[model samples]
Target: MNTHAMVMALALLISSAHLHAQDTVVIDGAVTDRHGKAVPLCDVIFNPSGFIADDSLYFKCDANGRYRAEIPAGHYNSLYSLDLPQYAKTQLEFWGWNLQLTENQTIDIAFDTIEVYSLAVWASNGGSQSLFAAFRPMHLAAAKLPRLYYKNVDGTPKAIMDISPTLTKSDIQASIDGEPVVLIDFHWSYEHAGQCSAGKDSPFSENEPCYMPMIIAQFHKPKLAPGKHLLRVRIQDHLSKEIGEGVTHFSSNSMGLGF
Candidate 1:
């Protein structure tokens, strides 16, 4: 063969050899604590968002802080993520590469520990609402947090039948269709930086000011039909002497509290 033809023949030989070597693919990863400690009870998914062992990109992490899922020899752009729902947190994960890999190839991954804090608030009415809250002496950051998530007696959250920032007995008793049995569930992101003071030449005017605190509640409930409703928020800031008192009214629709 001529020199050019010889080179073409050599290229074909290399391609043929590579095609026969790939067989099974391996998924490798480690489950570590915040301190790099290996975590047990971890499972990984091998789906399109996971691995290729099952054609889909999903699989579970095996014990020993390791994961290995086999896939056919080919290129795949699967997505991967952990399955932690109760808190609805999922994003950081260890699989689903955007590149191509051959069978029997091993892919390694590592993940960080996830953490969260929980606060429970009971519901009651004495023509108003009541609850206890506390904030200790610690440094606070500046960020908005999810304060509250309201739910129903069946653990289902209900929308505000009506909101009376300035709630009265008559307003509480009135109902749009009949009456709304709704309750407020409280939640918080716990990033406190609620302090801001404008120094000389501050852009803020006398009325516009900055405020930050430990607990700001958000109420996300099922949407209810239109009607008047009474909404109250009881807070307790143990560390802050000024706000550690009775349950305060955070908002209402009647008086257009949060309109």
Candidate 2:
């Protein structure tokens, strides 16, 4: 855990604590893999955007990978993550999205195998913090993604810090049907340097860009045959010296979205 990482995480946690008392919108959804298999007990984190101040919302999926989140009516972003220590780190998948929540909504998110993986370190307390995301494509070129899911050693909910700059195209590689594709064009997003920008540059530096700590990438539903198609993600992080590589098999029904 790096001291700067812990400081940054704490700062983001403090800033996301601004609670609002007003009408709220309810979000109900399921967390499933690309194959429509439920990912139970996963964590879903929500942070509404475009508000004077915002609070972080947390939810947990049941055995069927179903969860409900209540948040103020506003534009919001959510991250879905499942931490199954039993599986290889490279096998884990995480997902995130940005959307408006003016009323009750039902958004189902899907999970894809991890192509690249990263973690932030809290040097002050020696804790490793990371956000992992996965995605499954839908019929209308849309997707089902998971929310940010992480907990403290004390079993308390933790907010994810914006650190998206640490990841680059070079760190990830993907191929569809053996045809290489652009990494940046697939589900990549950054956090703005706002109130969450504190401690992003240096431990106590005043000027620095604060991007969200999570890295999101996805493969949209591509037109393929009705048989098995291969989706591969090769990840190499120069900074962490950690490599994540895996292959996922997806199937299509000619006209339907395949996982």
Who wins the lDDT comparison?
2
TM-score of each: 0.30, 0.36
At residue 127, what lDDT does model 1 achieve?
Answer: 30
lDDT of 1 at 147: 23
Off by over 4 Å in 2: 1-22, 49-54, 84-93, 115-259
For model 2 the local lDDT of residue 137 reads 19
Deviation (Å) of 85 in candidate 2? 4.7
Instruction: Give the alpha carbon lDDT tens digit for every residue of 23-50 in model 1.
Output: 5466455554334556455555543333
lDDT per residue, candidate 2, 1-259, as tens digits?
7999999998887666533323677878777765568978877666554222256666788988898887777655434455455233433545343444666767665544432332211111122221123432111111122122233424643333422223455766666456765543335444332432234343322433333334456433334567544454555444543434333334445643443
How much lDDT does each candidate structure score?
A: 0.33, 0.47
Superposition error at 125 for model 2 (Å): 48
Query: Candidate 2 overall Cα lDDT vs. reference?
Result: 0.47
Q: What's the TM for model 1?
A: 0.30
